[model samples]
Target: MNKTAVITGATSGFGLAAARRFAAAGWNLVLTGRREERLAQIKDELAQTSVLTLVLDVCDTEAVQAAFSGLAAPFNQVDVLINNAGLALGTEPAQACDLAQWHTMIDTNIKGLTTVTHALLPKLIETGRGASIINIGSIAANWPYPGGNVYCGTKAFVEQFSLSLRCDLAGTGVRVSCLAPGLSESEFTLVRTGGDQEAYDNLYKGAHAIQPDDIADTLLWLARLPAHLNINTLEIMPVSQSWSPFAVKRDQ
Candidate 1:
């Protein structure tokens, strides 16, 4: 039987790339995204594979449960879940950042991720088969940068949460892994900068950042690994990206 993988944020970026990779590998996919048109497009694109498209906002707690409860037959039993629906809003310092943006990040990245995981974990355990939950995180979680604020904190929660989950699900054979990528160019920057094209280009112009496909390929490898093998956490960065010197305030 072909395995099934459910990916959130399937409209674009890592999520979409992972969905395509999964389909190509002959896995059935349940794709969730906020954009109906994009969801439809992806569904059509993955027509060769079993694709169940759902227009969803992960932040909507009620909708998350509704979507899962409504899953029919074979799709209901998910073998792998890719929690790729997350974002970073605004590139301003914590003191200068908008509270609303902070709230949005928390809602989607932290609350939303946990919401889906909480809802489906029981089912994953019930399957009594090897299962995995891959949470999408970022370098911001470990190394702080200017204007990171709540977005960094949210990702930190993801990495930490993944570790804790592995402990809880240790004996159950439910695998947990967190994929953290650094300096990747995608809709992420556009969303963070609120669609400033110039800003987006400037940040990635010379940086050969890790592509969405790179991350997707990594995800596939993780999921395909033997059930006895579990990767607790894996972090990747573009060759052009690295740690920066600590910022220090000096007397003017």
Candidate 2:
């Protein structure tokens, strides 16, 4: 039987790329996102495959539960769960930050991730075929930069949480991994810059940024590994990206 995979934030970025890759690999998909139109577009694009689109805002716990509960019986034994839903609010220092943006970041990046993971853990454990939970994290968790305080903190939570989950699920046929990526060309920078196209463009001006497909390829590689072998954590950055964030030069 083809395996089933659930991916949050499936409308764009790494999530969207992963959805396409997995569908091509013959896995049934349960894709969730907040934008109905984008979700519909993705559904139409992947219409040839087995795909279920759920219009879900991961921040809303009740909505997440209801949406996942309504999934067709086939999805109950999901073989992979990808927590790719996340966001970054601003580049401001913590003291100068907007409270609303900070809260939104925490809600989506931290609480949202935890809630979905908790809700799906039982099903993963019960599935005798063994399972994988891939959490999309960031290198910011390890190397902090200006204006990345809360975002970094949230990703750090993901790193720690993934490690803890792996330990707790030991020998339970469940594997947890964190795929921390750097400088990927996605709406992430656009959203973080508050719709400033120029600023977003400046982010990748001089550097070779990793495309969403690159991260998706990494995820597929991790998922396809032998059942007994688990890749616990992976950090991927573009070749041009180096240790120092400030050293990344962009044309003015």
Candidate 3:
């Protein structure tokens, strides 16, 4: 029987790329995203593959519950759970950041991912054969920057939560991994800068940031690994990206 993988935030970025990759590999895919039209477009693109689309906002607990409660066949017993529904709101310092943006980050990045994982973990455990959970975290979890305050915190939670899931799923034949990417050229900067095309272009200019497909490839590798091995955390960055010197204030 072909395995089943449920990927959240499947409308774009790594989620969409991963969905395409997995479907091509013969796995039945259950794709979820907030945008219904985009989800329909993806479903059509993967017509040859068994695809089930759920239009949902993971942050909405009621909607999430309702969507999962009546999952159709082929999506009922999920084997791979990809908790990828997350985003960063604003690139502002803590003090200068908008509270609404902060809350949006917390709601989608932290709360939404957790809620999805919590709801789907049981299905993975129930599989009892071979299962895996991949959480898309970020390098911001470990490295701090001026404008990465709360976004960093939320990813930190994701990294730690992924570790905890490994401990909880030990000996259950269920693997949990966190894939943290340093810099990526995608809608990330666009969304972060609130659709500022110039900001998006400037951020990726000569940066050669990792592409969404790069992450999708990593997801494919982790998901295809032997049931005996588990990668607790994997961090990747584009060759052009590296750590920066610590910031220090000096007397003017």
Model 1 regions more than 4 Å off: none
lDDT of 2 by residue, 116-199 (tens): 988888778887445899999999889898789889999999999999998999889898999999888999888898899999
Clashes of each: 0, 1, 0
Provide C-alpha RMSD values for all models, in order. 0.9, 3.6, 0.9
Q: After superposition, how far is residue 62 of candidate 1 from its true place, in Å?
A: 1.3
lDDT of 3 by residue, 213-247 (tens): 99998999999998888999999999999987888
**What clash count does candidate 3 reach?**
0
TM-score of each: 0.98, 0.95, 0.98
lDDT of each: 0.91, 0.89, 0.91
Candidate 3: minimum summed lDDT over ten consecutive residues — where?
A: 121-130
lDDT of 1 at 207: 93
- The residue-by-residue lDDT of candidate 1 on 1-252, one tens digit each, is 788888999999999999999999999999999999999998888899899999999989999999987788668788999999999999888888899999999999999999999888877787644799999998899998878889999999999999999999978888999999999989989999999999999999989989999999999999999989999889999988888788899999
Q: On a 0 to 100 scale, what is the lDDT of residue 14 in model 1?
A: 98
